[model samples]
Target: MTMEVQFEKSFYPISSWNQGSQPYLASILFCQGRRTTSLSDIDLFAHFCAAAVPNLAMVESVDDEKIANRLDRVVASIGRKPLRVLVQVNTSGEESKSGVDPSGCVELAKHVKLGCPNLEFSGLMTIGMLDYTSTPENFKTLSRCRTEVCQALGITEEQCELSMGMSADFELAIEMGSTNVRIGSTIFGPREYPKKEAN
Candidate 1:
């Protein structure tokens, strides 16, 4: 199974400054995939606010209202509105990728807009197959999903940010209209994982 990790928690230990103290650029806290029992939605949202990081919580099979209600409470707590959010879509139809199916993206977006007033409903994001280079088909799938999501939400494509690319094929992704690309490894080099010890 694809591990569902908090973006901030993974990076916080190594960073020099606090979450919101970055002088030059802003950061986003992406909590992708399912919500575990240990971390409730309220806790996650509070962390997002406390860290002052924009959140992109990728919803899988969870009920939309549950997400909306949690967001509402978060807004109340922060006394702020319009939190940036992304609806992750499984454009590749890969079981390994963590996101809602393409068919369900529009409905989820709609729910986020109509049901979750606190969320800004920024756009859509997806993680394609790692082995495969970003292909035209993959781009097309995301484009279609974005179009549908915008239409369902009565918004335009320009308003929806398409975050679909990584260091591997960001060039093609840019040509295909990816507003955001994840290029950490390309700039920082490959991450070193700790080796396992024998039991």
Candidate 2:
């Protein structure tokens, strides 16, 4: 398609490589946004478990211990194939946000790490100010959460990821220490290109 998809991180969404991840599913390939209003979380997990190609890797919005325990139980029921999870943080302190308060991130990370053997505490994520440009402080807040999550769990920062950023401000997010980003529409959707010369 001659489109440019740019980013520097462990995960990259390149337009040229669209629909090319199926071959690499055996590796730890995480698909975000499994939750929907129509289906409960457990129901969604069940479907993923029952899928012919069940590569349900990481979930981004685990905000509390209750959810962590519930998901842990589900993962246990399906043998030892563990689910990687990210503890969502409400960095901007928005009342409308779905994640746990930033103050509670460590406790949640600990619960997911020590209490839930069936689930891996992959990292932290946040949906900062709903705009084209997110506040840099929001990114810093997530990085701080990562610091706390790592210290409390005795794990290195690399072990705990920071999944913050989307298409618009992903570069800035990365500059502020975002490891993973969600860039779906920017990659799969239309792109602007210069017109070709007349033949």
Candidate 3:
């Protein structure tokens, strides 16, 4: 099991969560949501590293070089190994989603592999359209991107993971060669968001 921790103040602290589940967890995934700038927040990265879970960070934009550089610095300063990075591709082309365009996913993955020595280029991920039934196209797009990325990097599929699917479509994702799936709601039920205060 991999835990998806939203790097926000309201979620239960990662350290506490890790203590109970570390042995069972494959990795701790830090999802930045639409807040791409949060990826550069060194304190957040440090907080996660402290938990000692194998870390995976999701990037929702195409500017991988900047994100990778920031992550490298943060990990290095804390004496932690670089976090595995996933390039989130906008497979559905929805205005509400966060990710690089599908057309640019290979380029971003290649950038992380070659340009960011401090980071491990783990793989590609995509949050499909809201409709659960429409996930196959997104999975196929990610699979194709992964194949192209692996070919370009001269590495086998095992070297890179495909982080597609969530609670709803994980079974289908696994059938289509997904190495990682985020299934928080299915296991824990829907999350309660902190209410916003008036400005």
By lDDT, the best candidate is 2
What's the lDDT for all of these models?
A: 0.58, 0.65, 0.60
The CA lDDT at 71 in model 3 is 68
lDDT of 2 at 103: 95
TM-score, every prediction: 0.66, 0.68, 0.68
lDDT of 1: 0.58
Candidate with maximal TM-score: 2
Off by over 4 Å in 1: 1-65
After superposition of all CA atoms, the RMSD between model 1 and the true structure is 10.6
- By lDDT: ranked, best first: 2, 3, 1
lDDT of 1 by residue, 52-100 (tens): 2334333222224456567656765777656766677777777876677
> Which is the better candidate, 2 or 3, if ranked by TM-score?
2
True-structure lDDT of candidate 2? 0.65
Model 1: how far is 2 from its true place, Å? 23
Per-residue lDDT for 1-199 in model 3, tens only? Answer: 3533332213432333222211111122345332235334433221121122333343323334566667666666677666677777888888887777878877888887787766677777777889866699988988898888888889988777677767667666666776665655654467778999999
* Clashing residue pairs found in predicted model 2: none
Stretches of model 2 off by over 4 angstroms after superposition: 1-55, 132-134, 190-199
